[model samples]
Target: MILNARSSYSRLLLMVVLITVIVSGSSRAIVHAAVNVPDNIRVAFFINLGANKYQSLTSVATLQSTDGMNLIWRDPQFSLPAGNVAAGNSVRFAVDGYRALVLETADLNAAIAVLKKIQASSSAAFVTRLTKSGKPVYQVTEGTYSSAAGAKTALTKWTGSGVATGVQTLISARVAGPWAVETGPYSSAYEAEIAADQLGSAGLDSFVALKPREGALEYVLRVGQEQNESTLPALQEAVAAAGGLNVRIPAAGESYALIRHDMTLNGNANKPVDFYAIPAGSGAVLRADPAGAGGINLLERSKRTYRGSMEVSVLNQSLAVVNEVDYEQYLYSVVGTEIGAKWPLEAQKAQAVAARSYALSSGMGYNIAHVVDTTLSQAYFGIASENAMAIEGVNQTAGEVLTSQGKVINAVFSANAGGITADNATEIWEGDDSFLTAGAESPDDGPQKGLLDWYYVALSSGQAGYIRSDLLADSGQKHISGAKYLKATAEGIAVRSKPQVVASVEPIARIGSGTLVVELDKVPENTDYSWIEGPVTPEVLLASINKRAKPQITGPLRTLEVTKTGPSGRATEVKANGVTVDVGVSDNLRGALNGLKSTLFTIEETGRYSILNGQGDQVDSSGQIGSLKIIGGDGTASSVTDPNLYVMDGKGNLRAGTTAPAFNFLGKGYGHGLGMSQWGARGLAEQGYDYQYILKYYYKNVLIEKDA
Candidate 1:
């Protein structure tokens, strides 16, 4: 008996070891060399789909969702086979509502491959549908229990998957229209069956079906027959866990791979392949043109042709087009659009390196793509706008990326720094970086406008303006007046009256700096180097401030003051009526009131102030104006030369006087003034500074290395 027990124990130990090896090996299979290399980054050219103009999708290749749960085909001459997803038909779910895990991708072929891997790894049924916003997502039902408790229990089992998991209480049957996840139109049924078997082995259940291909018989592998939407991220995690298969849901509508093949242009055929997506519909749609004979308009702002694929999906009730292009190719368009193709070679090279580093570190496209095609990421227009100079810059700095302690750095840059570089923490959100430092600008001739003249004029109706230190007559005493008065009474200080009498006069309307213009020294050659915006009205300021915040503010905006300045004289804290309302990154201050050219400025108001008497009236030289007032001059009345001269108050009230209330923004520089300045780099290059010197000067203690 003892001998038999010992033999059984040895067998059990052997079984345990085998199981451990298989589990560990399966985990490692998910990541292959191709996906691991960081060689190329995916960019979502289109994300917002509400504005999509596509009426339907037409493609020659069969399309499917990422889960291989459904199939869509469009051929004018042929009918769809049984079990295939019919165009214009909505996918139905098992229960009134079901939760699912989804994965999004711009490539249909890749989605199918990923779906097969997911099927092999997990024992869950998946469905495909365009999100309400138009993104085609693959979903797996964690559980279709009668109660939410059952769903929660199933979700708990996915803790090790690391996917975005959630429990959705489906209120009704999800009517996700027919979407497809398909695999090849094999030459024969036997071949298709073999492929299906492989997929089944991988854990994906699929079937073989006959389909038309180029006027011949063909068989295709298809899956995704259910239509229940669950926590969509679960499937993505499952695929990732199974074997690191890359599959993503397409934008809502129909996910398609847009291909622009060889075309005759100017009597010669040129091949520049590109891809796009469209919504799913009927009538030869799957086998038709991407835009249905009408070419889709993409990246309309720069009017450039994109040589990459796009995923069109609906997001937030709007249509978004995401462009997925290679990292180096994207840099071609960005370098040119950002610094201009006409810039110096060295400057362009520096910019190329900086842009590349910024793109990888920004993490803006972590969820969908690597980066956007707008200024939100970097200015990327695609291949159509590629210029020779920009191309040269990218080639020269190929595979170069900025690194700090073996990690990529977030290389940020701007237009002009007004002669001073900003500290990273001060200019942007508070963060310490060894690279960006506060110091004098590199270029000796870097955007210097000198000390410009500023002034403050006073007006009649209690409006006030700024009087320059040079223009001030004397450090005079301050006085209060008008219907509202402050006095030290026996019972503390009393303002206005005990019953709180409402003043008949409205509060002084502080005008924005945009209203007044100050003639100042500036870079005459380039106008954008210096700019002016508002004497913006209070209403406008309020509206703009409210848009960036919540709990909407109420305002007749009384005042705007720069409460703090950075080492470079950049506005760090701005106060609106003694409240610290302006707080955020660099853009907040510039965009606060009708847009200020830069934060290096001082506000000047012009107006006359006086002390108020006990009767709540202006106390003039003689007495209270309402009680016994007499207008008088110092010894002799001063005479004005200009007859058109009118004095205005802080409230915009005007009357005959020597001066009027006006404001001035005496500031310098353009852009956020952080990191490397484009013009500054050019100036440095002109001064014989190489690209390395320029980069080192702007970003201190940084190492330049090839990421390739």
Candidate 2:
């Protein structure tokens, strides 16, 4: 039994060693390279469905990767959202983890052969040649394989090449594997990925791959996976990122090699290519193979055709050691003060780009080194050089003092200089100078002729006067055809009707300032006062007026008398001063009075007239009445002393008891009370008050901060 147990233990130990080796090998494979596939990959394609505009469709093509082969095709029957599918339009498709390939044909046999050819090529050689329509086709670089049978098995699952039999064939080719191609020698993988993503967005599948020649990994972008079709456009955009073009592709059946020939030697042997980095300040400088060597062989690697270049102006550079507080303050001062009103839109955009670039590159930790693009010539006043330095990351805010024209000026608070207000006569002015005045009498001696200080002059009816420039109260001034009136009290009041009692009432003239009045006649003694009709009362009635006196009425008054016909019926006989008067049944007494109250009646017998209440009970009466006072025949009191108010026509003939429509005074402007309008802020700014002062006066308990 002991021998058997030992044998079993030895077998268990062997199993453990095998498991350990497998786990270690698996981990190492994963660590060999970092996958450069983006989490979110976007792709688009150009397709032609048919010739007729009515049936043609440019739809998004679907893509997928199985094993080492990538399949790409369009579903013509696929229905997309309405208005999304258009003829001759490009369609965009996006997917994560896998790259996109445009297959030239749906034929499985042709694609398998192409994959085999690519797999056989060297690592540096990514492009493969294919024959389409009996013509040799050169395409984007792809992978190579050892045998044609192996390639066929891997690509057998794909639905044959989708290319048509006759037309020039073109399609995307996607391959699986970490294929690496040199895209300039980048120091960081992050930079390589950035370039790769840019190329991928342009419909080129690329990634960071190891280059054994350099002993350092560089970004290698592949156009197609198994098949090589035209990818020159995508490669052009990617090369432009590094300001390179004139790229060369291998010819059909050519091995992986970059040939450099010295044209100066006529037929000299091809030499190895060299690469160099150009300093940022040198504009359009040619890159050299060695650090500082200049030789004619550098031109040997040049490919024919002009490649477009991307120019990024280094307007400003900042040191990487600045703190957040100083950086923010510096930015604030630059935007709020230096470039406040004088900087144009282009300069502002440049400044913003510079700031963002510095923040991103330096990680908000390092001091910046600034370099200005002096080629741009635009005048920016009030912008300090120190502020520019701060933006470029050269100096911190606290350590630098901004000098305007070499002299430091303390921050000054601005005030409201241009505005309109009641204090200044209504007028319009240009920059605190009286341009025009409006409303009221001309200034011979009445008031100031020109605009008030910090006020505008607006002329209504061509009248000139001064108004607070900051208080452009009037959007526009309007005039009433009739004369204007001034009140006696500073606290202006509106009255319905003019009142008698000369010593108690103050008379106001049209468009005139309030004038003090003195009484010259003895006040009349009466319990009631009379109502005057007009916009203003006579000056004689305002003399010695009691400032607080109110209007009252007194006189011999004749009242309308009525007698009831039944317990609940209308009145039968209505008389004024012992004469029969007309009485009409109406909903409102005011309406009935306006319609029939003023009919003149000839008084056959003079007697006191009493006005009965709605219940037919006597309320009041005239103590004594004369024959001429009561003179209406239609039961209306025309000339009765103290007759009820009624309407009259243009002929001055009384219209008995006719109701007149109520009057409405149409008002202008918004808000309660009349003073200090808010819409006038811009006018105030133009007049002279700074924006801060305007806000301060308009809003209470507010503080302005640089950051805010």
Candidate 3:
């Protein structure tokens, strides 16, 4: 029968409700609040910074009141000295420096000490004072102010008015009821009724009553009896179940109803109709004829039409069953009768044969029947079976064929033409004689078929026949290869210019350590270094040559000069004897020059030089010719005079009293020391370190794994 959209929706809803009841054994319940907060306190602000750099400041600081007004700065400049400030110190900046300094205490004592310290310091140029009536009032004592303007005016006026005292006031507010709940009171009966209706619609019951308080009549809307005692638990459950649901509850004996002017159903304004159920397990059948006298006129109304459709409600034993009469069949039969043709003959014969076979298969002990639409050529045969062989065979056949063709067939029997295909064929082996064949069509023509021409016959449980072949396309299976690790030596030894870029000749991976890597289609060439091609794999190798070479240090040569002095007696007479020799001198000069080797020294060539003994007395002088000695004298002998130059060791250690160029490579750490050190890694590895352990040591506590 043809059903309208509204009827169909109602039927679906009925089915859903029936299924829910059968599965869960209970209907869903709505939740309402039991208690709510009363006082409306304006939230100044909400700070949610956790235990971070700002948490301590917010927790320790307190808002202060001065002149009967509470004052709290949104961004007060306050700090405690880094070393002195403990975890929870209430601190504020006085005229002291910008650096955080600890407060002596949380009260006026600390505030006074900080103020006095600021006043004594010469660097503090700003004056601290209280304010009264928008004017500065200096205070002989120190305290927190209620407001910026008040503090300034009080301080200024105090200086002129000679007020040396201030009072501190603190405000504490208490919260009542559920801190986060919102509630309202209802005064009108109409409003309460509306609220009740809303709550009832939400599956929650609400009541309305008069709350007599101090002889005054007050209407109260309360959650209905079903939820009064269990409101809190139910509310919590509902919130946990479906995120959040609005809830409300009234005081004892005071009924409360929900406010529902803005209520909606499943988020939609329009409400959906409720669905009713018609019994299906048992039903009576329509007989072919009715007796004349006591019998009712069954045929006349039995085949009655309802808006081009018909419905039959039957009682079978204790069960009531309802079935739709195929209107299409009735129309077809009427047309056939008018034309005087045999249009219904085929369906009638098929049903009769099915009924007889069903009865025989059931051992003739139980009743069997056939419900048929002759004109539409469709029929349903029901039977009581001992073994159910026929039903089982039909179910098995249909399941196998449909599953093999990847077609989904519903459990119930129904006639559908769209799912039939030429490659998927079906034939009835027992109970009925029928075969289905899907008509062939070109790809461009699409499918050209009719429901009447495609027949399905059920024999056993879930088994049926259908047109076969060409129903499903063939799909190929895929084969996957196993993972493999590849090994290869570095073509040449060189150091990478950068970590990834090969520079000059440098050592690559160790000689015997086999670096497992994935194989690639191509190798990078003439590009400093080649990547592993793919992910590095694990493989054992006896040895691997370094891929990069170390860089050679090449530059201009540096020159260093050396000088020696002659014996004190010989050098002193050079000018007097008029001797000018640039070659070898005496044993003392040779000894001093040998000692000066490997040491840097400054040489001063004075026309005349006086040699002093350890006692600081001049012993001899080189006159006219010249006198020279190593800048820093030999360790055992003193110099002829004070020297300007000093020598330095390879480690840049300065030699006493010598002028020499410092060593070129005298820095801390080892290697180039600019980036990660391979030597360091080797050192760690030699000390029994894993790859991840090595990486963590060098890169701080960072993790290393496959590059996901």
Candidate 4:
């Protein structure tokens, strides 16, 4: 019977995998006698494509149809149980050469009814069998055809003529005709009748059938005789509206009949088949024309050549094309993009193994595709990105993978870590992965060492802060003075300050522009061991601190201090104003401070204060250095530093002027200091350490083994 698009979809023979394996292992040998790897994985290349809303790949591509569906190499064979084919009017189709567009349902009675309905429209035949789910299903078609294209044309032309509601679209690999629909897999015949009765009461036809599963008989209430889509909806809707009835449409495309082609004395009965349309030499050709200048142009820019079968299907409203490829071959482009193709051989091999492990361990075909061609999973650029070194890496590793506790590991890696790697829970999202722990691998010299000495200043307040030395501005001067500038003393050049420096004034306070006027040679050439920041104004400091910290800092930002640190001397906790914040996990602290480089820093205010008198009304009057009055002469103050000691205002009160100080930060390192540091790896490689050693230094207790 003809069905609408939705009804035809409902009539689809849903093919689901059912695997049962029994494995045995001993010290002498390991046995995998029952293991079954699927011959082909079905990926939804497209779903509901275009304004025309076609469902099958053949429908969209206008490929040829056949008397029987093209069978995969592993399909079980069967024949139509009844109808014209059973009545000797139909010829048995050769499994290899011919195919048919069959409507499949999980119920045997429904299959017979559908066959009768199709026969009423035109002369058609059908067959029946049991699905892996133990449900009786049916397969039926119009006539057997030798070529797929001719069959497709016949199905399309016949369906378009408005004879059937919907054209049969699913190409069956079986050489049978009868189609069936399944209803109930009830525990008892009584339960099956209850379901059948409910459908009968709702003006739907149904019956009870028995099937065997795992050595037990199951009673199923088979529903509907016609495969036409238009008739079932109203019945289903009525049953649903009636309520209290456990009626459900059979799952779409969930059942397939296993058909076998039989040979007769008149030579081989079935024609030879191509199985899954797989070409022998170059693999299955696809829409991507090999004759084109650069093969297929992906996303309109990158042209790529792929070694695998390509299948196109509809997804949502657009087309989804999947490249079905071997797992190892998929790594060629991945390794080349994840790490440069020119990387050291050992490093590339390490990367290849890691990528392979990740791919094998990951569940592919999630979004109807094996893996997206992006870094969201692994960076892939097809054949265009592959190189000799990448191929060598793949070859060397072969089927190798890093496994922990008998399962493949998820080897996650990142770029440079400044110097040290952080714990997995500490650097990435909170998770205690023992494999990812903090360790020091990067050298503290060379260009790597130059990452520390950079510095920044509050452009408005002259408050200075430190960033990575490599990120510093080119050619700028900060004319530092007061306690920051060194002064020659009896003991040597030292930071000039009061005896009780912390208690007396702003710690590390200075005046003028806090620039690094010292010669470049003063800081070692290839070393960037430290960074400094801020004499920042209250407003800017508050904004920056509140942005990164939780519970938003209240009041004016008064102080910022490193309250706690991790093993690498990186700040794990900090205090903004009076609020103590924990930044121990991930890169929370770095993100909090905008771009703090790393969290190893100390806080300092940038201005000095004068000692006040005991009365709290005036500057100190004692005859001491930096006091308001340095000396007394004729009851008057005199000193080299005292400019206006006792200037009387109009009210005869002594007044003096003072300056306010801003805040500053001094720090070290860059990033969260987690995982493998790319720069550190390079340095280690330069120092004769191999990639395996580098990986071991960062990730602990992982065994690199080849998959059997």
Candidate 5:
């Protein structure tokens, strides 16, 4: 019995060891990777969508509320609720039966004059442009009244020379129409605008609306904005009187309702609603609620899905798209996108804590908004980045935030740390945070050997792609020196069908070592922790940097060198072509040298590479040239850029190319190299560390606790 028990114990111990090995190794899942409400604190992200993708005015937008949208009128004082837009989802309550008083005018300038008179008479006036019978028309409307009888009473007083004496206007009720002189249902605003321009050249005023089309978005361009014409017969009569191109008025169920700051979109799945809000007080918001659980807020443009309700409103005339949800719930997407959707749960948990602290503390968005949806405020890509692991990480670390001296710390982290993190926030940003101190993971002073998973490589033909780090045989040189030029073990090394990555990708090109190449960067699978980006001359570097400089580099920029460095060898100040770039902000120094990837790089003046001829003597350039072909993963080889020269002998015998890059920037550690290193956290997590341990390791003297 003792012998049998011993044998069983040994088997159990082996099983545990095997599980640990599997968990620590190659665990990346093969997945290719809200604000508003006073009762509960939330975050609002100003996402650039549709036409607002570039402009401040969001002329077109798609808003979906999960529980149907309701309209609420503020007290007559017109005090905009806390965040400029309306606060609290009106799903709770809405007082209905409000009628809008609209006055129609043929000329826009005349409408503007009439609108001024209405507002002067104690009514909030808004101007709207609409298309009636293929003709452009303008309307100036009063905000709203509790009853139609009340509206009519005001309309009579206004018509009796109270608003404007000789305006030549018609009084209209319910300003949206059931028909329009329409064009198309384009897939994107860009495409619709192109088509709209074609119609404009033929003398037609055009407008576009981003609306729902069969479960997706349709950028619909019409002859004019929808305006007040309640019936089809009335529209037909007006079109006949104007007489141009025959209007193809859509059939019934096609409805367009619009107001500058007030919108009413009842749950008519068939109708396309165009809702905008004129800033009555500060800004106006209109929320569209979805049908049910099956309803989607925004489908990440194409393939992504998110939880919670989507609030749509106009801020600065741009459609401000905000995803409103519980604060902890928002982190599901935040943690996933910030780190990895399929990374080990503990690593993502650390990310969740850091992201929460940073977002809550940095109020770097539109008013009442805590953060933006970019690296400018940490990646928050909504539902597309969320996964099972992300959900777990966020839920497991719910409300947990890192705080220092009773305030939430700005836990800024980057891709890699080289080996040790930066001394403090001063290395990257302006001020220094006591907790953002250096923390070393490994004993090495730099990137560990063989730790790199992917390499930014140029082919023998000088084309760019990535190769697995393991496939590269060492060129008998340390990476801390000049530049990394790897030698392949065999001829015809296969490149990935996917650029800048390897692992489970298909093989693309079969090029041999006869091609001289430059390995620009050595990054891990999930972090741009190490990179190299130049050969740019002082003049070229000066041109790229001067565009962003205030005390710009003026004279002939001939000399460039780092004058001062931080604790992590990150450049704090630099002499750019003899000009001292000692600005108050350290980040400017990072952008000085051709906008380098990071400041922790050594400048290497290259172009002295020696090539061997058949006679065993080395020369600067090769005497004979070899055949070369460039292959692309895009399946179109002709699309890639190339030079008109070749010199390598096409086999690995040290034959240099005709021309080599001039100044190679050999660098390590991406980002500002401050605070926690994301890849370093990932490595520690894989080594069986918990979230709390990882957080304390990178951050100095910080307490991990629930904020509320």
Candidate 6:
């Protein structure tokens, strides 16, 4: 995988002497050990090439390391961060290799002719220049592959008329490395880098590298090439006072060596490089100095920086960028992103513990990684999101996690619960831990005090939901002074019985844009906490019901209503066109509803007619309109309703009796009402509740004891 056009990344291959021992083939025990509280973590920031949050697939990634970048070294048993990622200097890693069957020709024209001939058989053929035995030469090659064997196998079926019988397999790479005399094995890459820089200033090919210690990594300064045992004595002797060793670095392979400045050879972008006697890559770690002074940075991603080092490796056709960070340092960013860093310290602490617990139990990204740096798991935005208070919260609650039955709990959370947390996780996970239990909602002071901001509003029929603040305009205190009302800007929207977009729910009333409605009781302008979505035509709603509901709402959608609700008043089951579709959980209902934010809502109809029964009481004729008769002024009776009917409007104009109803999902909250609600937590924290108390409030009867 191409990480960057030019990039350097690797750090913390080991933690302690024991870790080094494990990595260096001493013990295999730790490899299989379960993760409880990991000292270091791997968070994949770039998945494939286009898989990052930024969605960029550029072949180059630049990195700056504070501890100095380390070279990666691995045997069948271990792979770890080795040494020298320096500060200020940018190290680049890029995807720069391909395997191809090559034919060397002394002349460029001959190579081009051969390339053209092969192109007829394979679309990837190319011609480029290389050096052979001190002479410049041109070569024709074809195909892209991460491994040499893959290219070799492809050569067997050659069919080009001009194909060379003496074809050689070549792997392309951009590389620069040199052999050198080594200095002392310092304790840190920072120390080694300073020494290497002094030599580099004096025009030596100097750099820092790492070697495994018992469980830690030690750094060495090396300077280089053109010197064998006889010629290297002078270079070694100068460092002999510092315990220098006479070391000769060998050529680096494309597997671990990348040329920072070399993307093309002899003006050919696809040509393999000639190392020019320099050591290209021997799996030697070259990196930004992270162990020295400054932090590591992802130069292309808005220049977002990080406290920890990075691991850049090949994955499929693109590079994988993984952030290697201390678990606690990781929380400095995660805690702030999950819960507001400016929020109460207690709330942040709760988020820290929960986030930690969730990461441990989530089993995400396989073992190659623990999690992704996105909300698909949890938002991890690097150092920019870090806050002092949030860091303090992380430090104060370090190593703590929520566990039930002696195991970590999957502490799931969301933005808002619409005043009630769903009680369905127990059903999903098949456990009855009290920590996952939730009770009926009491009162959420968050929306009341306006601290938990939202565009709250009520319709003329006394029904309400949160509206997007941007959609509403202030009434200019038109209703009353010192009191503001929001004027609805658009009309004829669907109002559903549930906030979800599920088709199983029958279409309800359509609220017009100019309908009189009350604005928020607290702040006049707010968020998605309450919203109205649509006035869906029956044709549209029917299609959705059939697509989502099992047993598929088989006919035209006549009536859709919530038939059952969980303890939190979240719709769990509904009937579409009067047919029962047993949606067993609130979350499932939410999923079936085109991923609506919540399931707490009410439905109303605009064109619906009501019947005055014998008791003189009005009954809505929504789904049963055709069953009743009406007495006209002339005492003549006719059928109730027709599909092609017109009626006179109040303005003395004629219009269709039914305008094909649509629905508006008017409800509070922005996520699955499960476990803790971010807004609710903020509200409780404002009410002087500590994180522990808040956790118990949302997650019932669960103890907030520290991890055992």
- RMSD of every candidate to native, in Å, equals 23.5, 35.0, 42.3, 24.9, 17.1, 18.3
Give a tens-digit lDDT track for model 3, residues 176-208: 011011122455766655555454444332344
User: Where in model 5 is the C-alpha error above 4 Å?
Assistant: 1-44, 47-57, 65-257, 260-272, 280-282, 294-305, 314-318, 363-365, 442-527, 537-540, 555-557, 582-584, 607-661
User: For candidate 5, what is the TM-score?
Assistant: 0.54
Candidate 4's residue-wise lDDT over 1-708, tens digit each?
A: 778998666556332111112222212122223222223222223333445533322211211111221211211132121111211111221111223445555444444555556556553243433232323334444543434555566567544554334434233332322122455467665676566655555544345543333444455544543323455666566655643245566553322221222111123323211111111111212222122222222322233555444443234423345556567767887787776655677777767767776666555534555455555456777777889998998887777766666666667665455456655554345577676657664652334342333222222222222222332233443333211221111221112121111344443334232333221112222223344444456677667667656678895554566776666666667776558854446357766665566655566543222354446554422223243343365676644352212233445333222234355556555445555554565567667766667667766677666545
lDDT of 1 by residue, 458-549 (tens): 32333333222222222232223211111111221111111112357232333332232121111122223543332345567767777764
Backbone atom clashes (below 3 Å) for every candidate:
100, 99, 91, 73, 20, 82
Candidate 3 local Cα displacement, residue 460, angstroms: 48
Per-residue accuracy of model 5 over 1-708 as CA lDDT, tens digit each: 456888999989999999989996745221111211122224444433346332322223444444444332222233222121222222211111132445666676676667667767653455555444445456665534434555566566666655656767654434332134644566565676566555544444455543333444345654532333344454444433444234455553342222222222234322223334322123334444344443334422332445555555544323455555667767877887877665678888888888877776674444545566667677766666778998898888767777777677888887677766776555667676788766465222224444547765666554555677666766755333345567776677777523234557666566665443556555554325555564465568767667767688774454466777777777777776457765557766556666666777776443334545447787542121222234457654432124322333335322222233345566777676677778778787878988887888888888776734
True-structure lDDT of candidate 5: 0.55
TM-score of each: 0.49, 0.18, 0.13, 0.41, 0.54, 0.54
Please, what are the lDDT tens digits per residue for candidate 6 over residues 1-708? 655533423223224655767777642111212336878777877655233333324344667655555555552344665434444445555443443545655665556656766767664554544343334455455554444455555554443343664443333221111334666566665676566555544444454554444544466655543213444566665545433433433223412232222123224544343111112223332222366535677875668888766666555555556777888888889887777667777788778877887787776453347887877677888888889988988898777766665567778777777776667643222245567646546234454454333444555554545554545677665433223566767875554443333467653456667655555343322344565454445566666656667667676665566676666676666676667764444455555554566776544333354446779898765656456565699987777554423333345333223323334344567666667777777777777877776766766644444533
Sort by TM-score, best first. 5, 6, 1, 4, 2, 3
Top candidate, metric lDDT = 6
Can you tell me which runs of candidate 4 are displaced by over 4 Å? 1-295, 300-325, 364-378, 381-385, 425-428, 444-562, 580-585, 588-674
Q: Which residue ranges in model 6 land beyond 4 Å of their true spot?
A: 1-36, 47-68, 78-289, 299-303, 314-319, 363-365, 425-433, 440-528, 536-561, 574-588, 603-658, 705-708
Candidate 5 residue-wise lDDT at 238 = 48
Tens digits of per-residue lDDT, candidate 2, 369-429, equal 1211111111111112324433433222112221122222121111111121211121111
Model 1 TM-score?
Answer: 0.49
Model 5 Cα shift for residue 138 (angstroms) = 13
Instruction: Give model 2's TM-score versus the native structure.
Output: 0.18
Cα miss at 693, model 4 (Å)?
2.8
